[model samples]
Target: MSDQHVYLEEVFSSIQGEGIFVGVRQVFVRFYGCNLRCSYCDTSETRAGNPVICRVWRGCEPGRFSETLENPLGVDIVADLIRDLWSPSTRHVSLTGGEPLLQSRFIRRLGERVEMPFYLETNSTLPGAAVDVAGVIDVAACDIKLEESGVEDDHGVLFKRSLETIEIFNDSDCLVFAKIMILPKTTVATIMPAVTSIAEINPEIPLVLQPVTPHRSNPERLIEMMDAAGRYLRDVRVIPQTQRVLGVL
Candidate 1:
């Protein structure tokens, strides 16, 4: 293993208001940096330097949490933080990011030492990187981006690889959930191919269709995509970002 430490943005405890684990209390380790620039990202602040303080919106008053240490913590130190944040109410520890696959080795090391189940939230653009640390994660929440989001690189190949990565995890003991962000520009005609691909793999796997928030360039597209997705996907459900509704961080 490399002796070098990996960069980490911040670590904090919060409720999991998205995906299958929605409403569950979780300790979130948000890693800094990302490979892709999704147009509708809400956590743009986390894309830079190691996060030292988190501005949390609580009621009318905003609260702040500070981290004395620097970014990119070593495995041992990260382990201790996970333990400190672990509570009877905590269901899982989420390794989120600008993109978690960017620091797969570091996250794998942290998962190896921690006792609680580890969950990962990824954009599903880096399948090979994700597979490298698949053993360390218990669950993966992957997002499939569409043209409306401005991610116009070879999405066909990226989405295919994402499914391959999901299949890899599905063959294992890990729980995998495929998520597609429904944008105003995303229509059934645009996303049907991707949805069909996922259904072909394992229809039993939970597929989450999340509506793009009002902040996006297109809000009406969300409703259209939801209706379109519902026609082909039996397990599809439309959910907005609950954190936004709750007005929390």
Candidate 2:
């Protein structure tokens, strides 16, 4: 297992920018690669092939950066970096990605070795992979992509898996929540089904309406979608990319 490692983009500490866990301090272990490329996506690094090396900061402080670590970094090494950067305020070890679920075994193994709680930030399109790690994850921050999300996915298949992923968390003690990227073209027709689908599965799970970008925010549209979602789901909120606003990594 010393040679076995997961490809990663970066590992750093920052606040939880979206979902019900927003504002909580977290150490983000961002994995490399993703299945879907949403047009409005801000995770630009995820679009490329796996990096030959994984970058980490020398310290947990926001701006400090460390020498790159080789790709497919051993679980022990990844575990050390996470432990090194963890701070007193750190809430959980956030397994974010290109799609963290893509590397289910790594997450499962890492969760076993780490002392911190594991919080998974994922695109709920991959239910099978979600199941692979669901048993180990402490909090499931699942993103349900809508048509307005501009990802290359079969809507029926996408929604079905999204439901399955949510249900995976529902059947467990993991805190589950959904975040839908509400674009400018996003309309009630496009939004209702997602909220309705989530409502049908578990209305108690919070839904976060995040505009494509925080700089050119469309508050009216965000509010409208929030209002529309509020009808079916009890806990729906409009949260912008506060990380982008506060200028934190």
TM-score for every candidate vs. truth?
0.86, 0.93
Q: After superposition, how far is residue 63 of candidate 2 from its true place, in Å?
A: 6.9
Measured by lDDT, the strongest candidate is 2
Query: What tens digits encode model 1's per-residue C-alpha lDDT throughout 151-204?
Result: 647767777777887787777778988888776666678787777777777877
Instruction: Please give the TM-score that candidate 1 achieves against the real structure.
Output: 0.86
lDDT of each: 0.74, 0.82
**CA lDDT, candidate 2, residue 85:** 83
Runs off by more than 4 Å, candidate 1? 1-4, 48-63, 215-233
lDDT of 2 by residue, 64-182 (tens): 67778878788988898889888899899999988888888888888788989999989888888788787788899888888767778787788889889998987787899888887
For model 2, the superposed segments whose C-alpha errors exceed 4 Å read 1-3, 58-64
